[model samples]
Target: MTLTGVTVQGRLNLSQQHLAHGLLFRDCHFDDGVDLRGAVCEELIQFVGCELNDLHADNIIARKGFSVVDCQLRRVSFASAQITEDLRLSKSRLSHEVDHVALHGPNMVIEKSLRLDETWITGEVRIPFSHVGQDLDLRSAHLDNGAGLALDATSVIVGGQLRGDDGFTARGEIRLCWGRMSSISFRAAELHKPGGVALRADSIHVSLGCYLDQGLTASGTVRLVGAQIDGELACTASTFTSASGAAIEAERLVAKDVYLDRGFRADGVVRLVGAQLARQLTCTGGHFENPAGDALDLTGITCTGSVYLNQDPQHEQCFHAHGRVQMCGASIGESLVCSSGLFEFPGGVALDADGLNAVGDVRLNQGFRAVGRVRLSRATIGRQLDCGASSFVSTENPALDLTGLVGHGDVLLTSGFRAAGQVRMRDADVSRDVDLSTAHLEGTGTKVFDAFGLRVGGTFTFQLAQPPKAEVDVRFADVRRLNDSPSSWPTRQTSMEGLTYQSVSNIPCSGRIEILQGTKAFSLQPYRQLGKVYREASKTKEEREVLIAGLRDYRNRGKLKWPQRMWNLFLEHTVGYGYRLWRPFVIALALVVLNFPIYHTAEHHNLMESVGAKESQEHHNVKHCPTDFPCFNPLAYSIQLFIPVSNLHEVDKWVPDATRGWWSTFLLGWTWLMIIIGWLLAAALGAGLSQAVRRQ
Candidate 1:
């Protein structure tokens, strides 16, 4: 009991001091508090360089270690203390004008470790429910509870690590709420409480890693709500500044890896909603500046790996998430790499990962630049969804809301991808190929690639895209093949009625009506899907010239002037476009040899008289037939007007009498135009013999 240079006045009662031999107090000067109430100090309890004004150790029972090294305590109560070994207040200096609790340890039981290296406390350092068996080191600690709570370890139970890293300094609010730590090194801690909560570990249960890494300078709110971190919850190169709300409120955190990126800088909201990260979430060089709201809110976060908001082209470093980086129903196992990032929320919704379920690919490709509304609606991507050279900028709605997206693979907005507005993929289920070749899709509002009921397995490429100003409504999309053409889709800005693409690679059948100009009518399913892509490119006469020009523009839809569209294209090339039974019997045998030379040059009499009429009545002797009529064959009245059921007695002997009165109107207009070409060649040979008897 060496008390050198002693000056102890009152209240120095070590109530139950069973000190065998250790109690040295050098340069001692205790004016008041030194009451180790009910003390049972067995061995060492040295207060070197002591000037202890108050150190009321309530229920103290220091069996072995306790040294207030360079002591200058005004008030320090280790309440319910029972330190067995190490509890060194290294380089200690605690102040208390009126004793606002310097280091009041509640339920203290430090068996092994608890060092406050370079310690200097002003007030408030209550270690609640304390049981520090191993590490509770406060390296270079300097707590100044000016604005309240410098360090209140709520349910402190740190067996291994809880080091307020290296240069730890807390002006206020560093309360480790419900603490139960193993590893929690605040690398360069300088937690400042502005709007509250500099670092409140809510339901804290850290088994390992939880370093607020490199030069951590927190302003407010670093509350890890329901935290259960086994490893990695680092805030590398951290510089968090909370304005009002969340500057990192890990909602339901159950972490593995969750670094707020390299040179992380968050202004406000960095809330990981329902966090369950078992792996990577590295925001390469994160800089989240909340414009108005949501600057990195991982809604239902469940990241297995890769969620790096990329821009790390070897640390060119830029994940400048201005605002709204909400991962809606997040479930990313692999890639959510926001390559070359800058997803600014102008109106709102910059990177809303709607129902996002990515097993692997969701890389917002190369030069990613989303202004607003990049909603991946109903997202379910197992593989490829690389937005190649991304640059989506929403006007009002549908900037890039891939509605009901279910991509098993390839769904890239290829090469130089750029969307202005409407890119709503309605009922998407793209298993493969949806590469908008050189993408530049823009629709401002109505339709750019609305893609209703979209389902592409492969090849739905809008080859070398640069056209889309608007209007590309893939109505009921079931696309298989269609690498666009006709100037890469400009059929009046495109609207594939009920898009059912089968095949169509280049599609420019030598200006087929300038690719069917604006198709107001004649929708024979897009010329039968461009005649099945010209019959799969075998091009049987360009697939019968685009299915007979889509059957004469659907039989001259309406208002067909220009001589009724040239008499419906001469009844569609002599009716093959209709039924073609040897093309109306070879145009009714060439209209019976051109109406037998126009009824033998319009003969003035003789409808039909003698084929063998009583052997021509003995060579036209006119015996019994003279009173009736004579013969002026003209190929027997042109076979009775081109044989409309013609067992004709020379077709009732036609007469063009009266001095050829214009040959009786030119033989009555050649027997009514050969009786309407023999009833349209017997109704197009009875509809091609009932379509060849129903194809046998």
Candidate 2:
């Protein structure tokens, strides 16, 4: 039956009817609505260029298909309908302002595809529990339900792809929660539901992949919580903007690969916490801007391949972020390259990757810049951590924090790296060299570089362009070799206590001594280590000089009582801390030469007398010499007094005549002083010789 250019004033109720032939209507107008409840049609039911108030086809069976092309309808319902062939509703205008549901297809089963191409829907299109065998294409469809749900395909199953690409537009939320589709594509689509959810596909499973890329724009949040995509989830060149909340929320999502790169922009937070990716997560040349909150959060994510947050090589565009990019507790199978990326979160953390575990190298170098702190504390890197040519600035916190990090390869902070705040790497363990050569670190009245308790397997280079502005703490740090320059040493304050190094670079002994002296606190270990290094190199002269300088400095700087201080002073002047071997002997010769003149002058004044003829008053000079003893020679007397263990009898013959005058008395006292000085000189000389021998 076919009707054209006809108008029916009353309702056409075809309930419980069975028709073998198809029904076709063209240019027809119905004032009421048509009801096909429980109707069975063996052929096609087509409506072309028709205007109807409502079409209720509940529990209807169509063996061939159902078409509503280029039609204007207030409401359409195919609830629980079973259609063996395709259901085409192309180029239709459906508006239900009172009921707010333009098309309702709950529990509907279609054996073939359901096409809504170029359709205009002003109310909700509810299709919960619907199943389609083939494609459910909505290409070029415009769905507008104001701020309400535009399309709700909850629990709907699509055997083929669910496409809404090529100029598809939706004004309200489009939900596909718990839906199972072969694949989903929204390329070149625009979804606008500002300040509310634009797309909610929670727990949806896609067999092939999901594409929201290539000029796709969403004005509200796009949530994909617990979604499972067997293939990649691509969002390349897509734009998502949320006024107050997250732009993309994909927590616990599982996908093979995730691409949010190449002109992808998110105005709010893009959270992917606990997401698992089988392959790479590429975000090259992406822009994430959330000034008050986190821009991109990937906490606890596990990726099988590398994560690229770097710049685009083809376009020379950098991956820029205005808020924090948090990846804490993330595990990556390969490297994490963020080279040439710019992250700015002033006075807060810019890139926080604390406790991250990556199997390959982590490259934050090559012009990478962060306006706030970049924390990687307790991270485990399998390969090198290259931060060369990077710039970090944080006024309130550490610029780069890598505390307790364990890295297997070299940690390079060299090559024009600049940090305006403290760079802390305390307790870090690196297998290879940690080079900071040519780097500049500026601090805000705190430690510039704090690496206390750090352990390095290779050399540590501190040959910076200039000395840091603040203190540097390396207490208890152990390195294989130390390569530093005097000009680069922190001049203001430094803490190097318990620092151990196997070897040092080529620096003068005096310069090395100055380094030890420049420490904020005094420790004897550095001096001993320096001396041992010189000794191993067979530089005896330099070693002696270092040892002497150490002793002098210790006496002056070390806390001690007056008695101990005096004893140290005496030892230093007498023997040069046992390093100057000829000091004591030279002093002994001068003492003997000066005292000879005093004895000879006493003899000429007749102040000397013989001890054997004391009562007879005989002078102890050469003229009145005693025959029993050696001649009373003034030279022999002077020499004998100096010798503490001599067997000469000169002292037994000579005596200062105290009975003659006061000059004789003075000579007697001087003789006694000489004997005591001789004993002290002999003891000091013996001690000095023993020390020198032991050192040899």
Worst 10 residues of 1 by lDDT: 615-624
Quote the lDDT for 582 in model 1: 72
Q: List the residue pairs that clash in candidate 1.
A: 197-221, 607-653, 607-654, 608-653, 660-663
What is the Å distance of residue 13 in model 2 from its true position?
2.1
Q: Write the per-residue lDDT of candidate 1 for residues 1-696, one digit (tens) a residue.
A: 788989989868776666677888898899886887767888888888888888887777888978888889877888878889988888878986422778888889988998987888888888898898999889878888777888888989989998887788888888887889789888887888889888888989989889997978999889999889999998877889987888889898998899888688999989989899888889887899998878889988998888888776766887888889988898988888888889898888888888989898988889989898899999998999899998889777788899889999999888888888878898889988998887887665557777878999988887646666667777668888877655556556566656677676654675654555454334667766666667776776776677667667666664556876765566566665554557876766777778787667554334322333444444442123443455466676666665577755555544444344665666666677677877766655665566446533
Worst 10 residues of 2 by lDDT: 613-622
State TM-scores per candidate.
0.48, 0.93
Local accuracy by lDDT, each model: 0.79, 0.90
RMSD of candidates 1 onward, in order? 13.9, 3.0
Model 2 accuracy (lDDT, Cα): 0.90
Instruction: Please write out the lDDT profile of model 2 over residues 161-208, one tens digit for every residue.
Output: 999999999999999999999999999999999999999999999999
**Total backbone clashes of candidate 1, pairs 3 or more residues apart or in separate chains:** 5
